[model samples]
Target chain A: TQLLEQSPQFLSIQEGENLTVYCNSSSVFSSLQWYRQEPGEGPVLLVTVVTGGEVKKLKRLTFQFGDARKDSSLHITAAQPGDTGLYLCAGVVLQGGSEKLVFGKGTKLTVNP
Target chain B: DAMVIQNPRYQVTQFGKPVTLSCSQTLNHNVMYWYQQKSSQAPKLLFHYYDKDFNNEADTPDNFQSRRPNTSFCFLDIRSPGLGDAAMYLCATSREKRTGGTDTQYFGPGTRLTVL
Candidate 1:
């Protein structure tokens, strides 16, 4: 079974538009991470939120950990063509001990210029 | 300089044949991970090594194996490849989990494996 689920498997919008991608789970996580991957490349770590209700911002991208620790969201303000890629959400369970990373299906965003 | 590097960005293997993917890191991180990602799907963890110790996820297939002979190098060995095993394999490096921010992974460009 998939531990995490991301909404809007794919999205395409004109440049300068705002978009929010969500990650949801039925289980609570100790920490969650966001990654962006370009074609033919590995995913790059964008941000990580460890505490429930924690929020982190990177440039125009804002990341928020759900108050319940069971969900998180990535909001990109004024999306640009550069923002086009696959966005993935992964979480580490509190159980800890080199366990497998639980990943969401991911969202593919295409910001057309 | 590349922090993480995987040899043969593209690999083709015959079904039922054995194949090995190699990853080396310049970051000298202590943890190395192997993940498989299909088109538009989440990257799934195959296994990982922390130093010389190997940890396998319960659901991973027995055909997949990994070895980390040293801190900077890790290897993924597929005992028997199948058509379903065709996917992009990503290698990632991370410092020990206790190192906070370093625990965030740095990934290689990934090797796309084609199993015929």
Candidate 2:
């Protein structure tokens, strides 16, 4: 079983539509980071939410950390075709500098123009 | 522009052949990490280097080895490439924080490997 699970394994929508992706976990995390990876590339960090109940915004993208720090949510308003990619939420395990990150299955979003 | 860079965007190796993937960072971060990602799955951490200390994940196979020769460069070596080893290899770097697990990692574009 994956420590982190993302909902809506796949999403396809028209341009300018809004959507939300969720990452849920039973285990608590020190910090959770969201990433967007395109085909043939690595996951790129979008934002990081450390504190429980923290909410961060990057332009039209908003990220919220659960009050328990065990979950996170990403909401996109008027998502564009450029936003099409795999969205992954990753968090570092309690272990030391091994820097091992537990990743969610991912939500693949395809925005059509 | 200081960022992580990966060499050989695409690598094709025969089965049982040795392969190496290179990653470099200009960010000057104190930590470097190597991850193997198969199709439609999450990136699995293989190992990492903090300064000169190497840490390997418990589940990482012995077939995989890594080297951090200096601050700016890191290498991932596969003793023998197998069909299962065909995947995207990602390199990430971060600065060590006193807070430990809260550091945000910056990732490279990645190297795609194909074992034939």
Candidate 3:
């Protein structure tokens, strides 16, 4: 079975601090996506990276896909309390002729003021 | 705006009681999915509908079933709600299925199920 492993399962940092979350996998994916989920709510898509070494920025959030398509990362330049939530990385994999997402365990981030 | 919606926001059921969770979408997308998310965990896809065709995940429990009676709505039925079944249920939709995960899925707020 293909699996995505996320590092720093829990992170707590002060406002204006920077942090990075890692998502690694042994299996190559066709694409990777990052999602942020607040408590009591479903996840919201932050960005999707399709190419190896691809990087996308959404405000202070930066997402990068590995050149091997086997890993990804999310970096926050200056996190605020509003950024506190769960960060999940999901990879698109073809299974039984159909494509589906395999998600990482996720990193729970708490940006304290 | 066109979006996915889930009912109740929160649901409570007795152990072994049957319950059905509802999902509706105004986006008129061709695909709808059901995901189970436990606290501090990633959303796990349970099943999905591509138009009228049903696709079940290999590991989804037999106690769980789903129905898409029409284009705008889908339902998830838990035959015997176990304590382990307590989790947030999310419904998402995509316009169409694409290779390499190009299809973007919009998610609803989710329904949190509590089993006692």
Give the top-scoring candidate (DockQ): 3
Top model number, lDDT: 3
Estimate every model's Cα lDDT from 0 to 1: 0.89, 0.90, 0.92
- For candidate 3 chain A, the 10 contiguous residues with the lowest summed lDDT are A92-101
lDDT tens readout by residue for model 2, B27-57: 9999999998888888888988888999888
Question: What TM-score would you report for chain A in candidate 1?
Answer: 0.94
Better of 2 and 3 by DockQ: 3
Q: Pick the candidate with the highest TM-score.
A: 3
- Give the alpha carbon lDDT tens digit for every residue of A3-106 in model 3: 99998999999999999999999999999989988888888999999999999999999999999999999999999999999999999887666668888989
Writing each residue's lDDT as its tens digit, candidate 1 over A11-47 gives 9999999999999999987789999999999999999
Identify the runs in model 1 with alpha carbons over 4 angstroms from their true place.
B100-102
- Residue A69 in model 3: lDDT: 97
Model 1 earns a TM-score of: 0.95
State the lDDT at B69 in candidate 1.
83
Give the poorly placed runs of model 3, Cα more than 4 Å off: B99-101
Tens digits of lDDT, candidate 2, A38-95: 9988888899898999999999999999999999999999999999999999976767
Higher-ranked by TM-score: 1 or 3:
3
Per-chain TM-score of chain A in candidate 3 equals 0.97
Structural similarity to truth (TM-score) of each candidate: 0.95, 0.95, 0.97
